[model samples]
Target: AQSVSQHNHHVILSEAASLELGCNYSYGGTVNLFWYVQYPGQHLQLLLKYFSGDPLVKGIKGFEAEFIKSKFSFNLRKPSVQWSDTAEYFCAGLDYGGSQGNLIFGKGTKLSVKP
Candidate 1:
């Protein structure tokens, strides 16, 4: 079994400021990492992911993450954030490289951006 950890419980920022969310997962074998976001009342959306090959990966809406195998960390970052980016961010991990079952999720980090 694997476990995910999000060190940031809550973050507050102004529009256009940079943002970074830390995510760490514990697993001995090969694992897949993800960052998911949810608006106030919307369902979870995939922000970014890492599997193989590139350690640095980019995703939709100007979001990116770097996968550090030795540190077991996959941190999410955005150069500039918007008020619309305000949402709850979750870190998840799968023991294997496949998404066959439910993802082990960390308690979400809530981001509130001031417009």
Candidate 2:
């Protein structure tokens, strides 16, 4: 079965600090990468995703992700972070291009951005 691994379980940062969360997947065939964020008491929202075309994909809130197929990594990055960005970030992989409806999620990385 496919799986996603987040290197950091928790991250703490100050406002305006740069952020980078590592995400690696274990899928051999075609796969879709996604970054989801869940704020406190809020449902999961799509931050960014990469299925095809350009490897660099940008998302809302000045967030972006780069898909590196050779490295099996789709790391999320933001030049500057804010306190409001504090939330649980998840990395997910859709196997076989989402054909079988199998989505493997990571344990998630809790980001605490201090004001």
Candidate 3:
């Protein structure tokens, strides 16, 4: 009973441009991946995470992510983007066993940076 899907709800850029956001998850076993960002009022900030070896992971401002275990997918990249990176991009998932991490979000992707 795990679910997390975000195929871009609203994303409009201009400042610098270049940002990809598309995360999908249905879980098969152990999973822990997240990419949260909220800058308009600031609070949630962890632009990358994939609790495992390393299927490509990087966090912070210049975000990056790639954990494609059989296409469960975890995609969030930014080659070039500014205007404070605008914000509101959440794609989280945590289902290890007993389920206590308490994070299964993905109904947000509002990034509008027109400067």
Candidate 4:
């Protein structure tokens, strides 16, 4: 089965530090990629997504992700991060070849932004 993998399980950085969380998906056919963030006590929120059109898509709160089909990667990036950005980020992929709701997700990357 296709899956998603995040390069880092935990990441730490000071406020204002640049952030990049590596994410790769292993789906043979057309796929949709997404980044979801969950704060300490909040529900999981959509950070960014890539379905079609532009390879690079920007999402809420200065977050963006590039869909590099050549590498099967949809890495998330932010020029600078704030303490409030600290959260658990998940990389997910929806496979078009499978049944509906066939979404695979990575283990998740915990981002800790220090002030």
Candidate 5:
């Protein structure tokens, strides 16, 4: 079965630091990619997504991700991160045909931004 991978288990940075979270997907066919963020006590919110068209898509806030089909990778990036950006990031994958079913999420990356 295809899966999403987030290599960073935990990330820490001071406010205003740059952030880049790596993500990799293992789907053989067409797939949809997404990045979701969950605040300390809030529900998950969609940060960005890529279904088609441009491989480089911008998400809410300053978050952005680039889809590299050849490498089956969709990595999230932010030139600068703030304390308010502290949250759990999840990279998700959904088979285009099997979507409507469920979203396969990564193990989750906990980001801690110190003020």
Candidate 6:
């Protein structure tokens, strides 16, 4: 079965700190990757996506991720994170050629930022 798993359940950091959240998926076929972020009291929004092309993809808010097919990983990264970055991050995917385009998401990674 296809699924996603986020290694970090929660993370705490101060302002201007580097951030890296692990993400892994168990799918053997073509997949469309995505990272969605939900800020405190805000709706979920797209952070990044990898459909077809280069493995490294950049998204809004100075965030980026690298898709390694061999490892079945798409790790999110940020050089310097801000207090505003405090939010829950989710890694998701859709099997392009599978039955449906429904998204498969990980439980989530909660991030806390202190000023």
Off by over 4 Å in 6: 96-99
Tens-place lDDT digits, model 4, residues 1-115:
6889998999999999999999998877677999999999999899988889999999999999999999999999999999999999999998666367666889999999999
lDDT (Cα) of model 5:
0.92
Question: Mind giving the per-residue lDDT tens digits that candidate 6 earns over 1-114?
Answer: 788999999999999999999999998777789999999889999999999999999999999999999999999999999999999999999865546688999999999989
For lDDT, the strongest prediction is: 6
Candidate 1 lDDT over 4-56, as tens digits, reads 99999999999999999999888877678889999999999998888888999
Q: Which sections of candidate 3 miss by over 4 Å?
A: 1-14, 20-33, 45-67, 71-73, 77-82, 86-92, 103-115
Report lDDT per candidate. 0.90, 0.93, 0.87, 0.92, 0.92, 0.94
**Which sections of candidate 1 miss by over 4 Å?**
97-99
Would you list the clashing residue pairs of candidate 4? Answer: none
Q: Which has the higher TM-score value, candidate number 5 or candidate number 6?
A: 6
Residue-level lDDT tens digits of model 5 in 30-100: 67899999999999999999999999999999899999999889999999999999999999998655436
Superposed by TM-score, candidate 3 places the C-alpha of residue 113 at a distance from the truth, in angstroms, of 9.7
Q: Which 10 consecutive positions of candidate 2 have the poorest summed lDDT?
A: 94-103
Pairs of residues at least 3 apart in sequence or in different chains that clash in candidate 2: none
Residue 11's lDDT in candidate 5: 99
For each of the candidates, the C-alpha root-mean-square deviation to the true structure, in angstroms, is 1.9, 1.5, 10.9, 1.1, 1.3, 1.3
| lDDT for 89 (candidate 4) | 99
TM-score of each: 0.93, 0.95, 0.33, 0.95, 0.94, 0.95
Q: After superposition, how far is residue 1 of candidate 2 from its true place, in Å?
A: 2.7
